[model samples]
Structures are given as structure tokens and as C-alpha cells.
Target: NAGVIQTPRHKVTGKGQEATLWCEPISGHSAVFWYRQTIVQGLEFLTYFRNQAPIDDSGMPKERFSAQMPNQSHSTLKIQSTQPQDSAVYLCASGRDRGDTQYFGPGTRLLVL
Candidate 1:
């Protein structure tokens, strides 16, 4: 299989712009993971899905961030009203099942001016 695929490897948006990141998981993978990387947070687990069902997303900000795994093969993370603080590398990963080792995609880097 083609591993995980994340589109728009890089994105730049002005403050208040909305950013949408996309991820396509590996075939037959039932678990998908999302992470955000910043100097402060290092690597924060934002959300995850098991069998295309959202499992947990406690790390995501309640107001401006949302994640969706509408199907087994793909997921999306959308950030509304972006700001400079939102600039970070968003990573997508997929695994066989819960607690399994997740294979990650290259990543989508967001730059907010």
C-alpha cells in the first residue's frame, strides 16, 4: 500500500484565515491519528479515530479546531480563524488498531502570518 498521504505539504495563511489539512490513511488501517508540533507543545496528540470513528480529541482546542474521519481511508483537520499561534506542523498517522504503532505521513506545515 501507499502508506499515509497528506496533501498540501505546506500551507501559509494570514491571521484569521481558515486552514484545512487532509490525510489519507494506509489501506486496511482502522486507526488514524492526528498530532500538532510546536516548540511549546513539542508533539501533542490532537485526535484519533478507530474504525473511522472518533475515539478521543481532548487535546484539540474547543473553539477553532475540529477533526473528522468520515471514512476508513481518509481524515481531515480544519482550523478556523487561524492565528500566528496556530503555525505548526500537523501530522497524520494510521495504525492497524488501537494501541498499535502508527505509521505517519510526511506532515502539513501551517504558517500563519
Candidate 2:
């Protein structure tokens, strides 16, 4: 079984352009998480879902960045009017639930110029 799949391993866009990233969680895993990593903030939790329902998203920016789990197997992160400061490695992970260990996928590296 594929542990997790993150599409578009690398993305580059001009400032103000939009970028969308996709993540397909492992089969049977109910919890999916999104994170952003940068030199300043390090690894920070962005959002998560359990049984396809959003649970937490306190770390996410109020605007431009959003994450959603449409179904059990896949989720998406969308950023609108992206800026250079938005460039970072976005990670997706899946696990049984909050207390269980989550498996991380190779992060999607994004660059905004």
C-alpha cells in the first residue's frame, strides 16, 4: 500500500499566482494532516482531518491557505494570490488518529518568485 502520495513534488509560480497541492493518504487511515516547514518557523501543523472532517487549523494563515479532506483517501491544499513569503515545503501525513504515529510523505516543495 502506498503510505502517502503528494503530487507535484516541486512547484514554481510567480507572485499572485495560485498553487494547489494534493495528498492521497494511505488506505484505511482516517487521519490526514497538513504542515508547512520553513527556516524561520520550522515544522508547523497547518490542519488535519479525522474521518474526513476537519479537526484543527490554528496554525494556518487566515487567508490564502486552506486544506480540506474531500473523502477518506484524498485531500487538497490551495493557496490563492501566492506571495514569495508563501514559498515553503508543504507536508502531508496520515495515521490512525490523534495519539497514533503518522506517516509523512515526501513534501511538496513550493517556490514563489
Candidate 3:
């Protein structure tokens, strides 16, 4: 509900295709969630959620990227029309609550060709 980042650690897709990444937060720790992207520019915030309700996704590209927390156990990040620049390590992290201890998962490495 709060934290878990997913999809694939290494995802290779062709340009103009679509890609969906998933994350599963730890059980009983679904109060706050956030996603980050690790690219050449360094890590950047992507989105955040509370109680599975979207709070902020302003970091995502308005045109092609979207994220969702459909349930308490998992979340997803979907990219429409994949592009070469979309390549990066997408991270998933969650916490029991805002300002609480957070845990991180292995990033899903996306390589758009």
C-alpha cells in the first residue's frame, strides 16, 4: 500500500511501445509511498502517495508517464510510448507513515531502444 517499487530490473523495449513497471511495498507499511528515477542527471522525484491516494505526481512527464496505487499491497508505474530517454533505474520506496523509516527495493532498469 505504501511502499514497493517494481516492474523489471532490466527492461528493453522498442521506441513507441508501452511499458508497465510494478512495485510491492512491505506488508503493514503502506502509509506513504514515493518513486524516484535515477538517470544521468542523478536521482529525481517522480511521485508520492498517501493511503493509496495520489498526492503528487508533478515530477512525471504529463504526456507519457503515469503511476497508480490500486491496492495496499502493490503499485505500478506505466509508461506510454516508450522512448530512448526513458531509460533509467526506477526506484520504489515506502514507509509506515510520513517521516517514518522507509525501505527501498531494487530498481527496475529500463532501456528503451
Candidate 4:
């Protein structure tokens, strides 16, 4: 029961550089979700994985956002050519099933310069 862990709680990136965020979900949880929280967008769903397979990614930006669940316990969100508009809190959550309540991590806050 290590809970969810997200690295570098805060990040600053150049206007056109790559930004990578990491998340380690709770053990035994099979569903992982990514979301972007902003003052304007509220909570924008990014993507999700179930049993290490991508279930949906319709909420991700078409240009530079991508997410991967390489294994059971960890996932990553990568942004290429980051821009000011990308500045937001990236959150990771996990649940036992699709309809179960998700537990959220502290989130990684990104600031694009």
C-alpha cells in the first residue's frame, strides 16, 4: 500500500523543450488515469490504461501529448516541444476497476517558460 507517487512535484520548462512526468500507481490497481487540471479547463481527462493496455486517449492533445503504461505499477506522460499553454498540474490516479473510486496523487505542476 505505497499509494501513488509522482516525481518532481514542480517543473519548469522552456517554451520548446521536452517535458517528462512520471507516476507510480498503487500496487494491485489495474486502472490508471491521467488528467490535466487548470483554472480554465477544470479537469481535462488525458488518457487511461487498464491492465497495462491503453483504453482511451481521446482527451490528450493532438499535437504533443502522449501517455504510456509500460508496466503494471508505473506510467509516464511526455510532452514534446512544450509550450506555455501546457503549463498545468498533471495528475495520476488509480482504481481497482473502471467504476471504482480513483485515488489521486499529489500531481506534477509544470510551468512553461
| Top-lDDT candidate index | 4
Better of 3 and 4 by lDDT: 4
Give per-residue CA lDDT, model 1, range 1-113, as digits (tens).
Answer: 78899988999999999999999999998999999999988999999999988899998999999999887778999999999999999999999998888999999999999
Candidate 4 regions exceeding 4 Å error are none
Candidate 3, residue 6: the lDDT equals: 62
Q: How many steric overlaps are in each model, in order?
A: 0, 0, 10, 0
Listed in order, each prediction's TM-score against the native is 0.97, 0.97, 0.88, 0.97
Q: Please, what are the lDDT tens digits per residue for candidate 3 over residues 2-111?
A: 33556577889999999998888888775545455654668777887788999888788899999898998888889999989888888888888878987888889888
| Alpha-carbon runs more than 4 Å astray in model 1 | none
Ranking by lDDT: 4, 1, 2, 3
Clashing pairs in 3: 1-72, 2-30, 3-25, 3-94, 4-24, 5-23, 6-22, 6-23, 7-22, 9-109
Model 2 lDDT tens row, 4-111? 999999999999999999999989989999999999999999999999999999988999988888889799999999999999999999998887999999999999
* Model 4: how far residue 106 lies from native, Å: 0.3
Per-residue accuracy of model 4 over 1-113 as CA lDDT, tens digit each: 76899987999999999999999999999999999999998999999999999999999988999899999979999999999999999999999988899999999999999
The residue-level lDDT of candidate 1 at 9 comes to 99
